[model samples]
Every structure is written in C-alpha cells, then in structure tokens.
Target: MISGVLISTLKAQQASVLQLRNWRTLNLRRTVVSPRIAHLRHRHLRQKSIPVAANIISEFRKANVRCTPSGEKIFKQAYAKAPANTFSCSWELYSPLWTTIRGEDTPDSLCYRNLNVSSARQWRSRQAYDICISFKVYKVWEALYTNSNIFRQLIDDQEKDCRDFSRCCMALQPLWLWLKLVVKEGLVERGDVDQLPEPSMLRDVVIGSGDPPDAVDLGLVNPAMCH
Candidate 1:
C-alpha cells in the first residue's frame, strides 16, 4: 500500500507537470500560427478577386453613361466595323473608350482568338457588359480607365483575354468601395448591403430577406468562369 501510494504520488506529480506544460504551450501555438494564418489570408484574397471585379463593374452602372444592350444588334455593329487586316479609327476608337483599355493595339500587340460560334457569341456577351460599365465609368470621369493604371499598361500586350481583363479591374479597386458607393448614392438604399436589419421602415424595405442581405447575387456561376 505504501509503495503504491508513493507511485501514485509520483504519477500525479508528472501529470501535473505535463498539464502545466500544455497550458503554457497553448499560448505559444496560438501566437506562432502566423504561417498558417498567412496562408488562410492568401486563400481569402484569391477568393475575393471575382467579386471585386463584379463590384467595379457595378460602380459604373450608377454613372449613367450611354450603354448599349448586349445582343445581336450591338454585336453586329461592333463586328461589322471590326478592323480588317489592321485598319483603325471610328470602331477602334469606340473599342478603347468601352474596353477600358489604355490604347489600341495592332495584330501583334492585341491578338484576339477566333473563338468558335458559341464561344464567340459568349465573348460578345461579355464584351457588351464591359462596354456598359466602361461607358458609364468613362462618362463619369473621362479618365476612367486612365485612373486604372494597370489597365493603362496592359493595352500594349494585345494578348489579354477575359480573365486578364477582369483580374486587372479587381486589382484596381477593392470591391467594398462599390457597395459603399451605391449606399451613398441612394441607389441601393440600406440594410440590404451592410450589417443587419433595424426596427424601422427602411429595414423592411431594404432587407427583404436572408442573412447578410447585402451579399452580391452572382447568379449561376460556372466553375471555369472568370466573371
């Protein structure tokens, strides 16, 4: 009985020491997780670029510029005048104004893929959206694209695609700015975009339903989509 008691006392002492060590180490683990935290932050940053692009597009919506609807008509018009074998003016002038590009490019500087029928149609659709945003933003500020310095540098490349274009816009401005601007301009109203619903008429009006009511409605995103 005496031996067992001594052994038990020793074990208890060891266990107490272990527990103390664990307690002390917990703080170190929490403090030293910088790498993991940084990785998580990078992942979050990568995830955020799309919404930022979308928001930048939305910002131009309020500027109320001349926007042509994306459909056969606008596509045909832009296509009809597309520079054949590297001619310029009129249509190409419209291209820079609406493409949000720094300047026009020659065949070598700006190369466009000859997408198949469906892909070409899709490309036109995307270009229409770009045009709408660009026109509005341009009208709001004649230097709208020039403000996006990255875009200014990209015009010379001519090989950039939709992904590159969208990514460039995302890098220009944080998406949160778009949400805030709509609220400020009274275009979006309140609650639907910010924190929570309040006990008032505006609450019911803005936040019709759902958590984080202000969340951007992305509508049927494809895994391969860059938009």
Candidate 2:
C-alpha cells in the first residue's frame, strides 16, 4: 500500500511540472508574437502614407511650392514652436508657417496663383483656391513623410478629416448651387472675388423667386470644395 501511494504522489508532481512548462512556452510565444503583430501594423501604415505623401507633394508642386531641402529647413525651425506630442506629425507643426505666409501682404501672397497665370485671374475658379491651399498644407505632409512614428497618426487623422470635409461640403449644397450660378452668369467676377460670394448675393439670386435653385447646375461646385 505504501509503495502504491508513493508512485501516485510522484506522478502528480510530474504532471504539475509539465503544466507549468506548457504555460511558460505559451507566454514566450505571446511575447514574440505581439511584437511581430505590431511591426506588421506599422509597415501597413507606412505603405499607406507613402502615396498620401506623394499626392501632397504633387499638390504643392502644382502651386510652384518646393518642399525639398528648403521646406525641410522651414519645418525644423517651426517644429520648435510646438510642444512635445502636441502635433501628431511635423506637418501640424509646420502648418502655422503656411498660414502666416497666406496672411502676409507680400508678393508670395499671389505666388500661390503663379502655378497658372490664367487661373490666378479667375477668382471664380475653385482650382485656384485648391492650388493655393495645397501649397499652404504641404509643409505638414512633407514633415510627416520624413518621420515614421508620427506618420501613422497622420494617416488616421487625415482619414477622419476627409469624411468631415466631405460632409461639410455636402451640407453647403444650397450655397454651392448658388455659387455655380453666380460663376456661370459672371455675377461673381472671375478675379477680385477674394471670398465666397456675399451672403446677400446668394440670398438675392436664390431666394428672390426670380430664379429657382434648379436653374443652376450643381456640378459646377467642384465636388470636393477647395480643401
């Protein structure tokens, strides 16, 4: 009876040891697997941002804005102004520079228009606004492309903002139609119109009962707006 009892006790101890070994193996595997998963996620994000970065660069280039070495210098200088982690990407840090350039009353103010001289004269052309704004927003993307850590966050932010921009443009459907008519009829000057057609102008053309909303082609609003 004593010998039987000893054998059973030894068997139980061996089983416990085997169970512990299996648990440790699983833990080791998880530790190794977790990092591999994270690396793959990072790679996917980088791949996605590459094209986005290229598109952004192309947009700026259309406006004759260069984002190579000079832009890099500007980016680094501006980066110091923002607090740590305040900006997800360097582009966010560099955005203020573009805005500052826009507000300044310098030759470069119209420089955004230099991309196409003819388009510059046409304030009614949505392309002009897009070209100009692209130049302004280029610095942020340029910086983002240079930094991998922040680039992932930038892709997420841009995706979310894209939806917002689309929604906002859609909500302005009524105004969009009005602007089209204004542009078509030349009521709004092709040049010299710095902002949206005056609210009063929109009210007069659409609400005055002289012309119905259907009179204007909504397709003229440039589906995306000048974002």
Candidate 3:
C-alpha cells in the first residue's frame, strides 16, 4: 500500500510540474510575444503612412547623384533609426536650390572673390538704409558637404519649440550662413551633401506660421536689395 501511495504521489507531482510549465509558456506568450508583435505591426503601419518620394529619388539620379544600392539601403536604415517624430524636409524647395549651385567645383579663391564683389555691390545699394542685422542665406549645393550630425542637430533644435515667422527666419539665417562658410572654407567637398536638409524642412523653420515675417511687406527680399 505504501508503494502504491508513493506511485500516486509521484504522478501527482509530475502533473503539477507539467501544468506549471504550460501556464508559464502561455503567460510569456501573453506578456512578451503579443506586445512585441503589436509593436512591429504599429511600426509597419507608420512606415506605410510615410511614403518615400519617388520623384525626389529620380531627381537625384538625374543630377548624377545616384546612391549605390548599399547607400540607399543605409539611407533607409538611417531613417529607421531616427525617432518616428523626426522631421523630413521638402524635396521641391531643396532640389531647386541645390541645382542653383553652379560653381561648387570652382576653386575657393574664385568663389570667394565673386561672392565678395557681389556682397560689395549689394552693400553699396543698401548704404542709404540702416542695416538692422546682416542676414544672409546661401544656396546649398551637392558639393558643399556637411555631416548628417549637423542636420540632425538642427532639426532637433527646431523641434524643441514652435516658431513664428520672425523666429523661424532667424533660425534658418544662421544655419544657412554657416553652410556657406563651411563650403567657402573647404570644410566639405563636391558631392558631399550628406548633411543637407530638405528645403521643406528649411521652410518649416523659416516660415512656421505658413506666412512671411513682419518684414516681408517692408521689401525684405528686395528692400532696395537691402530694404
């Protein structure tokens, strides 16, 4: 009778252990697997909602700015690594501006000399008006290379707070001036546009209110070329 009792006890213990194991497996599926699956599904939906622009990619190709398959892959990888809230700038404004960089391959001396003369001419035209601040924005070219970190930092800074028109333009002017300085100083090279922000992104910072700053009516663009 003792042997029979021992056998029954052993059976009961094995059953209990097996039951506990099953419960644990089910619990893990519920707590871990399900949440992971849901997260993946959410990511997929977000990606689907934000489609990459085919036309912009095509324009890059047209400009002889084609990325290698690996490079394209890395670009996508970078995008994936960025936070979901990261801002993407517009290609329409960016493309036209980049295309205007005609002399990126020219020597620094020649570029600087031309810009100097141009600045002088503009300055003379505006000598009658009191200059509030010397605001300048330079064209971004494929040749003027900056690292991705600069663009990332700029976007991060812009997103930290909402900007109105004057605030937005003020933010952009400094960055644009810096980009020109970077190129003129030969800190970057031809086709080194790794850090170039999209024009749309620039626009967002410069005119966040979807309108021009208060000075626009004062002939900010022409302003006697200064006004």
TM-score of every candidate: 0.23, 0.32, 0.30
lDDT for position 170 in model 3? 30
Write the number of the candidate with greater lDDT, choosing between 1 and 3: 3
* Superposition error at 164 for model 3 (Å): 2.7
Q: What TM-score quantifies how close candidate 2 is to the native fold?
A: 0.32
Over 4 Å off, model 2: 2-8, 27-35, 41-72, 79-95, 98-227
lDDT of 2: 0.42
Model 3's C-alpha root-mean-square deviation from the true structure amounts to: 12.3
Name the lDDT value of residue 155 in candidate 3.
37
Ten-residue stretch with the least lDDT total in model 1: 103-112
Q: For candidate 1, give the lDDT of residue 36.
A: 93
What local lDDT does model 2 show for residue 40? 96
Give each model's clash number: 4, 2, 6
Worst 10 residues of 3 by lDDT: 129-138
Whole-model lDDT values for every prediction: 0.35, 0.42, 0.41
